[model samples]
Target chain A: MDEGRRPDDEKGEAEETAELLREYERQIMALPVQEHVERMLTTLSGLALQRLGIGEKEPAACSPQEARLAIDAFRALTEVLAQDEPERGGVYRATLAQMQLAFVSVAGGRAAGKGGAGATPETNGEDDGEAGKNGEGL
Target chain B: MDEGRRPDDEKGEAEETAELLREYERQIMALPVQEHVERMLTTLSGLALQRLGIGEKEPAACSPQEARLAIDAFRALTEVLAQDEPERGGVYRATLAQMQLAFVSVAGGRAAGKGGAGATPETNGEDDGEAGKNGEGL
Candidate 1:
């Protein structure tokens, strides 16, 4: 009887886990494709903000490479949505515009910190002069 | 010969369109599932910000209902990712934390504007006094 009880308890737990998984799968499948897309969009936006160090508590989290990929991926998806669902696309466009603005701000800050990496010779010189002024100010 | 040419040209155009669609589908299929999820996350983030009227040029675009849905959807998706993909999910958690802060700020502003709509009676009375002061100044 003890042996039988041990086997039954294991089986019962296994069955319960399987049932839970099946219910989870069913809920996911029941959601509309658009809802899934919306969830993805929200996740990507958060990733972008994190990568850009926007609103991040830790500025050290900024990753230019990851941010670029996230932003590019976002633009590509939004462009497709714009054509397929123009009504909702307007909101996407607005969001993209703001993201671009944020990217520029972050990128500009980085470039300035690096003394204008990839800047033209003239621009580099100008940046150096500005840095000198900033140094003086400090 | 003219009739044949007309029919052939129409068939050729249809085939070209079909080929283009197939190419697009192939490109989409070749991408890793993670990329799709990333793109969706970005889109959701943008939608959330747009709904929240954060960084939005048009203040009228603010919709509390949509913002709530976007934020909820973002959190749900991020929570799943935290379990399924913890390495990348760290970024998601950071994003969610920032998002919550933004939500609190926006919600607080709205409540203030509404003269503490859902505040305690004492708080509401205090808000009304503040409003009275502004009204007198006006």
Candidate 2:
């Protein structure tokens, strides 16, 4: 019986697997898509900070290109969220501002390191607070 | 005088703009690409945590799909870092494990909320310690 009638057992296993998949799909569909976008924004913000060496203490390791890319991605996504989820979008906008400020600070440090005034005229640490408040363009 | 001699002044301004751009390009080129990859992984890890609702106290906002996407992206980038920067790669691998564990724990919470045993049989708060230690696959 085991040798010749195994098709029924195989079919049962296949059905079980299909049922499991359906259940999984149902669970996934229950989650709000907005939550995913929020998570993505949070992640992109972290990436931007990392690119700027915010917590790493290695300003020399800062990558303006990567930080800019991450920030741009965050901004694009945030704009979409703003259209529908304005409240959450505003929160993300604040987060984006902070990341941009960090980028400027790090990039300024890089410029000073190379003995150049850099792109940002106000590269001094003294001016950072004001620059951030004023929303200086990147 | 203003009408006939504006071309030289305009040409000088264009040359200055070109010079500034060239300088900016040089600065961007100086940053290590490896640093960017590491930052990217760091960002992805944070995104996974956000998706898992780790910091938000809003487990209902958990999006397993987003969390899994972030984790996968982190893992893929980490593999590349491991090839050239083994030390940092190992650090990121450890970070990845923590994120995966968080994913399982949150997913378990969600399942429990739905009155199900969940994908992880050991969904209790106590088992989380060892489950994380054992590196349970997502």
Candidate 3:
């Protein structure tokens, strides 16, 4: 977090990240580490979808409550992963920061008497088209 | 990708990954990075939500095309991230891997003429309860 400090040496950073990963692996031994992260990711993704009302056939199906949960789960885990390893956690930090912003945007938008993600159907529709055309499309 | 050989020095792998991340970042930069990833994440999640169909006013709103798009984008990015940096990219690899599986599940289920994520409503409901107790029930 130092403003003027140089980034961690990539070599040292990688080694430290590897060590932390091993420790995390041991910490999550009760469940397959992959499976645990997947579930949390899926939960967050699913709830975000609902908040956007994309999975629904009706007008709006946003559930801000559920979306918050998914976001929390992601943040909670990533924060743990980030502990004592800012260099290694940079990607997750960026990833979660964007997510946090997007979630807050939606929440804030709704609070301003606008609407949830559903408020921008036209924009979302365009994204769907553009996103659909890019590679495997899946 | 070496099967018999041991992993590279953390230095070697980290350098390679840095190179790859730069490549992927460049590729993504043409696109509004945040919007693009959010769309992909939400698309996949929305598909998952449709499969679950919680809080729905009607039947499934599953879109195979959009779901495929989401899965494709996630895989494409993560695959790039995972190259040569398994140690540092482990979290992203795990994150996207599960998303790919969940997206595939939804897609495969659709192809097989089965239900969507809606098939997993029971489990999702419980998550809802647990999520509600967390702060910021947004």
Candidate 4:
């Protein structure tokens, strides 16, 4: 008897979303903790690549907003990686620097043409230099 | 018939190690994935703090090897979190950068004194700069 007969639809959609989130939690929990970590890193790398337009038809398939997020995600995780391992410290930074380069190569172009503020992955040069310095000291 | 009673002892030790690993896996799997990520980050922060002598009598409570493993775990989980959510880009970075700052404040001193290779939390200054640049463009 309701005008649109549709309040239930929205409720159902919300329920579906909740269920999907729960399912995701379950799938993630099913793996060993270390395994989960490995998978997540792999996923993040793939997402960064995709957003950068690595394999997609469009170069830089993601919006500038998405690029910023990818850049932040990459750096945050890289810092953690760099701090946690003394012997492997430089490896994660190197990987992150490369990813950031891929991101900057495309995002920088888009930002220039459209007048957007890009994440500026160019700083990795300094980071690499620092890592190299650290390596020599070690 | 046995001379030294050594085979049984080795077998028992191996069994104990396997059981411990299984228990660790089980404990990790009991929590939701998000909870796992949260705990991992917290652990990383605490470890960094301990290494920096923030709350403990000892400075560098963790060995470099231990730090490396912790870093790997943190980075892997963060990547997973970053890839999972589109709207929460800035949130994870904010959390991570803050922790890195905390790490830097303490670690910087120790690194300077001991001639140790630092974790490079100093980079966050430039990261903040980059984030600000991106924000203004938006």
Write one digit per residue (lDDT tens) for candidate 1, span B49-121: 6666788777565654445545555665565445446888999778867866666567556656666645533
lDDT of 3 by residue, B18-79 (tens): 99989885454333323333443444444434433323454433343333333443444344
Q: List TM-score per model, in order.
A: 0.41, 0.36, 0.28, 0.35
Q: Which pairs of residues collide in model 4?
A: A84-B67, A84-B68, A85-B68
What tens-digit string does per-residue lDDT give for candidate 1 at A73-118?
Answer: 4555565455436988788777877776776677556656666645
**Residue A26 miss distance in model 2 (angstroms):** 30
Question: Quick one: best DockQ, which candidate?
Answer: 4
Worst 10 residues of 1 chain B by lDDT: B129-138
Off by over 4 Å in 2: A1-138, B1-30, B57-61, B118-137
Give the C-alpha lDDT of model 4.
0.49
Candidate number with the higher TM-score (3 or 4)? 4
**What digit string (tens of lDDT, one per residue) describes model 2 on residues B90-126?**
8988998898878777765555665454334354343
List the candidates ranked by TM-score, beginning with the highest.
1, 2, 4, 3
Q: Which candidate is the best by TM-score?
A: 1
What RMSD value applies to candidate 4?
18.3
Ranking by DockQ: 4, 3, 1, 2
Q: Highest lDDT: which candidate?
A: 2
**Looking at candidate 1, what is the lDDT of residue A112?**
67
Give the CAPRI class of candidate 4. Answer: incorrect
Residues A44-121, candidate 3: write the lDDT tens digits: 555555554444564244545434444544554454344424674586667666666665565545543433333443
After superposition, the stretches of candidate 1 with alpha carbons farther than 4 Å from their true spots are A1-11, A117-138, B1-138
Q: Provide the TM-score of chain B versus the true chain B for each model in turn.
A: 0.67, 0.61, 0.37, 0.48
For each candidate, what is the lDDT? 0.58, 0.61, 0.45, 0.49
